[model samples]
Target: MIQTLKLHSLKWLCIALYLPFSLAAATLVGTPRGWRNIDWLDVFGEGGGALMVLAWTLLILGSRPAGTVSNLIFAGLGLIFVSLWQDNIDEFWIIPDAQLWDTWLENVPMPIGVVILTLGLIRWYQEQRILMAQLSKRERFRREHRSVDPVTRLASADYLEQQLDVELRAARRDQAPVSLLLLDVDGFDRINRRHGVAEGDRLLQALTDLLLLNLRDGDLMCRYGGDRFAIMLPHTNETMAVIMAGELTAAVSHFAYHTHYEGERVRLTASVGLALALSDSPRALMQRADHALADAKQKGAGSHASAA
Candidate 1:
């Protein structure tokens, strides 16, 4: 609370000073109305409105951070409060008709305040919508937390298996094709031995990002296990899957990653294996891709093999 007050001290000061100024201005320019002449109903309504506006302003200042929207809201409410306060003062003090400034003060601010308040409300609505979208994205990630790999920040092998099962079922129903690409970083264990484990982890993280950039929108990638990644492509045949595998291997070979401490430029290559599903369970399909990967590794770095 103290921090909030400190942050909005200027706004609070303006409000504090405005109250006394309004009171003094009216008292100086007008004569006090007689007890019989004072309208109690107008006093209650206008005074109550001013107090409510003041309370709203305080709440806004307390809860919201100092920003453009908060300032706009404060300004609008301040004007409304000033107008109501002036109107309430009229019940006690009778200003002559010639004192047009008093009339202007009582009447002018209300409409301008309404306009400003409307704009503030619109902006507030837009702000809330953006906040809600980000919250929704975070909620989705939270629900999928168990299916996420901590190292690469990609989906895990378990997530890949689950999604592959769903896609295989859909493929059978629609008589469409689905393919899988299994990629292994060439000699990843050698890199881990040469550099530190931290550097190897960093490389994997960077590689994950690189591979994602190379993937089509509908494709899904997962960290299948250590030094290996899986890509699931829907509505694709063996030929297109093999083509994509080549592109992915080329992307990895061209990527130059520098170590953190030494800044040593390290070139990398990946071997890719392709498999197209055909009356096979998720486990059987993955096994075929694994066999293809083994064949690619035997052929050497940056090689592509297909078991479709």
Candidate 2:
């Protein structure tokens, strides 16, 4: 568990030692106030707050992966705990007027900790928004697990067809345009041959995450087949779909996929095809997209084509 926490135990130990050292320093420089003169209420309140903050820090370190946000939060909480601990110590000890370091220790860290904590919280909120978007994508297909692809955790080809039919009917009723994007991983077979099938599966999963991040709300993505993905864009015209397809292709080309074994970074590229929903049937629209995809592949890697 300590190893899994990625050296958080060392951080915790350091903080724990700091508290005692701070108390020892205060005792060394200051005289203990009489029992009647000590403010027991202030000590209890500040001490309790410090303990609570310490608990929260431990909870965060245990639950979250070690990253920038987690580190900021942990450091911020540790500083706050130190400030509170110093305050509690001050309640029971009387420092000389000449000693200014104790005052700095109690006052300086609180505001700095607050500022760091606020920044961490803002970053955490943004992270949660991205995670929520990803979760919503998976939640849509949760009810029909049989129609979800295991590798990418995306909807299957059958589910994509079903959603296409539904979206097409709604588009016709509203007189709005709908578009389809077909994306194919370029040289995926070569990747599989060079880096095992497990690595290939991981690459597909990473690609799925990238696609989800680029998509807007209400867009549906599905694993069409082995290395092909289909996206249904409601209310999107051919021009917008084509632009999105080009962006996705560029994003894939820039992505660096790493191998699990040798940790070697591999660059990947994709070909994308865009088709407007002119036909009433989902099968016809998919066929047009598929034909366009073949044309895109012929043009070479990272190419995009739009069907008329």
Candidate 3:
């Protein structure tokens, strides 16, 4: 968590420096308003707003990775917080009429902040759309965290079967084709024996990321079991599924995974099986994919087979 926060140090450092300077400016050039002249209502309201804005800025920086959307949102929130802080301070400090800095501080940032915030939100909407597309597969399983595998963060076998049933029904109703691909890491047990289980787990996680990057937006990838993954491709036919399976096989073969401990390059390969939905049951589809996967494994590493 500390390391993650450090990734957003730019925003935090800015806030830290800005706060002291704003306070020092308020103290140096302005006289403290007497208790009788101070507006308590403005102090409470503007002070609360500034606090809330600061909270929001911290929340955004903490939750999101450092990227374009995060940077924009952080900047906008920072500016808004600064403006509100100045406004709140103005209630307690009486600046000379000749001094325009206080007015500039209170007025300049708010509208600029709002414009930047609007642009950030628009980009955020687009980003969410892509993520939702990627997540649509897992969403079919009711979003149970327990159903997610700890290693790959993909749906577990039981959850995959449940979602397969849902997709099977949808396919039957719409008369659309659905395909399943089963991929198993070749020589994974050898990797574990040679490099340790921790390294093996790292390999699985890295392979999961690679597969996800290669899959289509709507495809659902799941951890069927150890060293085995299943993918559900809705509205895809046998030929397209076979092609995708081959692509996955090639991708895994090309991936150069390195051991975390030794930094030794671990070359990898995978066998893939593709089966189109013929029956309206998840069991039938999975069984065929499994059979095809077994055939691919028998053929050799980096091989793929489609169910007849």
Q: Number of clashing residue pairs in every model?
A: 0, 0, 0
Backbone collision tally, model 3: 0
TM-score of each: 0.57, 0.57, 0.72
Residue-wise C-alpha lDDT for candidate 3, range 1-308, written one tens digit per residue: 46667899877888999989988988999999989998889988999999999888777777788899998898788888889999998898888867798888889999999999989999999998788777765454367888889988888888778878888888888888889999999999999999999889999999988988888767788999999999999889877888899899999989988888789999899999888883468988899999999999899989999887
Backbone clash tally (model 1): 0
Q: Which consecutive 10 residues in model 1 have the weakest lDDT in total?
A: 134-143
Task: Give the better candidate number (2 or 3) by TM-score.
Answer: 3
Q: Give the Cα lDDT of each candidate.
A: 0.86, 0.86, 0.87
lDDT of 1 by residue, 260-306 (tens): 99999988999998898855788888999999999998999999999
Cα distance off (Å), candidate 1, residue 294: 0.3
Better of 1 and 3 by lDDT: 3
User: What are the per-residue Cα lDDT tens digits for candidate 2 across 1-308?
Assistant: 55546657678788978978988898899998989998778978999999999889877788787788888898788889888988888888998868898888889999999999988988889987787666665434334878778899887888888888888998888888889999999999999999999999999999999988898888888899999999889889877888899889989988888899999998889999888874479999999999999999999989999886
